[model samples]
Target chain A: MSAAGRTVRPVSIASFAQSQNVRKDNERNEAEGLQPVIAEVFANVGITKDDVDFICSGSTDYLIGGPFSFVMALDAVGVWPPRAESHVEMDGAWALYEAWVLFQEGEIDAALVYAFGRSSLGDLNEILTLQLDPYYEAPLWPDIVSLNALQARAMIDAGKATEADFAAIASRSRRDALSNPKAQVRHDVAPDVLLEDDYVVAPLRRHALPPITDGAAAIVLAAGDKALQWSERPVWITGFDHRMETHSLGARDLTVSPSTAKAAEVAGVADGNVDIAEIHAPFAHQELIIAEALGLDDSVAVNPSGGPLAANPLMSAGLIRIGEAASRIRAGQADRAVAHATSGPCLQQNLVCVLEGA
Target chain B: MAERCAVIGVGQTHHKAKREDVSIAGLVREAAKMALADADLTWSDIDAVVIGKAPDMFEGNMMPEIYLAPALGAVGKPMFRVHTAGSVGGSTAIVAAHLISSGIHKRVLTVAYEKQSDSDAMWALSVPQPFAAPLLAGAGGYFAPHIRAYMRRSGAPDHIGRMVAVKDRKNAMRNPYAHLHLADIDMKMVEESMMLWDPLRYLEACPSSDGAAAMVLAAEDAVSGHYPPAWVHGMAMRSEPTMFAGRDQINPQAGRDCSADVYAQAGVTDPRAQFDCAEVYVPFSWYEPMWLENLGFCGQGDGWKLTEAGATAFDGDIPWNASGGVLSSNPIGASGMLRFLEVAMQVRGQAGEHQVDGAKLALGQAYGGGSQFFSMWVVGSAKP
Candidate 1:
């Protein structure tokens, strides 16, 4: 509340679309994989690229194994004479955040934000190890799954969660995934049966881990009169913020995600009654952690779209949550929803987006 | 109208081939700390942090700002990361400045860094992609043909590129933070250097280095704590696809449009006469002249003549790269910001050994990707 009287403009998600999540998309290049999705989003919104004032994208070169991967992906949008474009090498959710901030500038009326990832080229776990401290943690070569397992184990040892609780989350997620056509993993299973699955890492079973996914997602954001003209019901972003934690796992408390808590607080998660919460927790146990950190009640419908456990497309998954939550609002299924996106190991960084029906 | 913004402080590390003494976080912190100290503030004084870098693969880290946020003292605060290839550094600074100009934050810390020593950038640039030609060679190989096209179109002599190399490397000797201090570097040394890409010699190319650049930007009301604020006169960013049917990769329209927009905002009818100095991205020596024309400092096809006339020399009418520029040290992500920071340093009179005398108005420019992305800004000693 630096400026109490500042008017908070309503930023809405006008339309959203995404590509099918697949393990390997060898047939389609990066731009080709993203073109149809962008086309679908624009068609749904009844607008073209020319209508948008700003264009932002989220992507990573590590996934493509090259530099300027996002720059090449711009070909899908066909920027001929150049445009006001910017890129973030993070999840698409953060790109939306940047777009949201640009909207606050009041100069730009609308923005198009998108993200893409191809996890099929290399070993996802092995590649994520590079995100650690190069001189210290990376030299040890601990993969992402093993690191998450450490956090899960610490939570279990501290009596914050249990193996049965992890199975229950996986069961509910798979059950919810059955209704999602875009979900990669969608099969209803009993929690008791899921408890029989072998452990990928101690205290974390195979069911708790997210599948390797490749996909792309796009969202169009419009403000003021443009938002009203684009949709009958606009999913307005009321509060949005993101925070980060230390890179060293040992330096942070493994049992709790301070970054997520801080982001949720800053995003005004406690201000209103949220009917649905979409948390980008790739691991089953991490969902419980995020749920607790956000202070959500049991009455709040969590992950109705199956969340990341079903279709975790690295860079695009976070943005997909915001899209999904906004879809619920647009459909009049919920008055308010909270979408969360996390980056780095064990949620070293987190972004929270609070959307409401208008 | 937007709120007024100014560069309150700037900091940069000594660029080198290998900064093995510090980790990536430590390297960025060195510059961030110096910027904070120069601004006469602490980490808590800043409201947010924006980081930019060329590619995560350059440091073997994907979305490094996640891990780097806390080290830069951005925990519990809003943080954003920007990546637009080589122009990322400049774009990062612009993004930070915009936060203030948009009246969102009073004080913002913008940082950009690249640890090329951690991973081989050549390998990162050569990753094979389906449907694309096997351009297995590094960045130099990709741009060499473009340089040849510039030479053919402009009809510039071959000696022009060598002269730029000698001039920038010599300027590097004056800046202690410059990575390559070739005290005896000359035309003879450049001519004998290895030819990595045809028409581009090794000495003509920028050296891979590990370094970081940081700047503390503040709104007009927040500038009272600092002296000699480099007022931001104008800023512009433009980007087009890397490849298209008839796009000019040699002299990108994006760069020209970006410069034109910035110049218009800064009220510069003539860049050559109005601006006291300039800092343009020149990873390859020949780019200095090419950018001189693209930035509207001179007419198109007449840029190389400026180099030949010695107008771009350190002691010339419009001195370019007085702080050695990217030709001497390129941390990829930080190189573009270094250009912007050097421009601010000149205007603030903070550039100790490399300070240009009586520099009032200055221009900073950065272009990246296949030269399709461009970001530029105009700053002056007086508030606009």
Candidate 2:
């Protein structure tokens, strides 16, 4: 396989906890908001910060309008005696991937992966616009909603999907989110009613847009014997891989996500029956593209936790996808699941994780 | 078990205060291309790409790797970004190494850089927060007190910092890519320089530069052997709270713990004698001696004595910063990688004029976030 893709040791998501999704957590700082979530994740598995061998976090400084925001967020973990730690500027899904890779080395048995973001702190549209090509696209200040709208229009023109399809996805997600106590935008609106909503940017309507959320999420991972020790029903990560596409919007066919397709294939998503899929689709129409790329059929229940549509917390949304999928498997709601995380404009990069319960 | 990983290629940009000629993508490409050429491989040979930088604010672009992915030939391949403060560059290399050492990938390309010229780094680093203490004085003002603390505790004369400033600048003269080529640097010149912070002259601090460093790491079996590989022996990272009650800021416990973890893996004891040389992150001149104690190269309070005795010079028993180190060329993010890369270069005998003769083993250390984050690695010429 191109001299890559060697076998990795089995790692399990022992526990997962997320902060209550909210529009703005004005009362608490990033670290303070994350403390309880970290406590929950640790307490879920009956462990503490001392039990984990390493700690890694995912976040972006741009959201906080400063540099090294992740540095201060380390307080939540209470690294008193010092700990082996690292951070990623991307999403928490990648942070988990890194920890999983280290697990393959047969070094430490457990690690903590977390991500925090306060999307409400700044103009998410302007902040996300800065993520584009500086010289070519970012200068134009095409907000995130407008960029996703461009992708939606391209899909509509290709006859791959329609405005009604986008609303249907959003309608199903928010309705499912009603059961999720932590979800920010839980509702029971129907597709027809959602279609009546005015478009935020042409093809994409207000219902299709994700709520601007400020939150954090954490997942405790254990490998080998520790995985079995952590949970009575451990959700084992069977396969994990991530891929990237070129940044040029004009060069890519917006109708499909080749990166997702490649990552899904590499992660062996089709190897078993995927009973549930937790896809991080910030934009409703993008969910269709990701589902198609994952090669899932109608039988596969999607967004059981409402996905990112109901509570998209920027950096943590993708990580929450994995947490949700693993939680479903651990709760005996599913036997097999697929979790996907996306970054960059129009999903230029994507990560896929396949989980199963023994 | 983990597979062995080795450095098969290394390349870096000619550091400057402002690389106005090239775009961010173009600047990174220069180092990536050179690393590929050195490895006798093409972009297609790389299984994945791992990049690191200080912060998106430094360049005014958020996560620039997404945009520069195509430029680094990361399309259709996995690309990752690391941001662990100033130690990010070393952490980036360690992550890339793990890809091979873990047997998940054969050959991976890692790059770390900082285009500080794009934005005012001083302003970006010290941006005001709502109710927190203002760090408007930038890193120098924040660290100057720590340096002063070292002086007060160690009972070392002020000239020790001036000697380090002179030593690294002279070493930079031998290294062509170094940003500061102070051929005339001496104790007198450093002593006469403007005092940016009390007890810290302008010459004693690192210069803000635009540069990038890259390396191509491969699994043991994947190496072509065209160039003598610098085998990675051990690598580690540790972190602690920035400010804690009774924390030893002078010689951080995290740094000592990190170095101990790495040394144990590398089967190293008596670091001063076990390693031939070391490249440490010393943004300010006094950090050279401060790190000596933290890294266990010498005893606490004796690090300045080692410096004064010429124990860390090129001709000394344990030379430090033979490639000018961070003091001569600080790209913030890339500075840590340069430390790791220089040791790899030394072991490969590819350091040219700045090469330490017959260097068989060496250490590379990087710290960030008020000396709370530490990343260190040991490399050897022989297969460990």
The candidate that wins on TM-score is: 2
TM-scores for chain B, in order? 0.98, 0.99
> TM-score of candidate 2's chain B against its reference?
0.99
The CAPRI category of model 2 is high
Show the lowest summed lDDT stretch of 10 residues, model 2 chain B.
B218-227
Write candidate 1's Cα lDDT for B1-384 as tens digits: 278899998888988999999989999999999999889989999989999998788878777886787789998777889999889999999889888887778999999999999889898888787677766888899889999999999999998999999999888888999999999998989999999898999999999999999999999999844559999999888998866868888778888889888988899989989999999999998898899888888888999999999899988999999888898999999999999999999999888888889999999999888888999999999988
**Judged by lDDT, which candidate is best?**
2
Candidate 2 segments exceeding 4 Å error:
A1-5
In angstroms, give how far residue A206 of model 2 lies from its true place: 0.4
Q: What docking class should model 1 receive?
A: medium
* Overall lDDT per candidate, in order of appearance: 0.89, 0.93
Q: Which residue pairs in candidate 2 have backbone atoms (N, alpha carbon, C) closer than 3 angstroms, thus clashing?
A: none
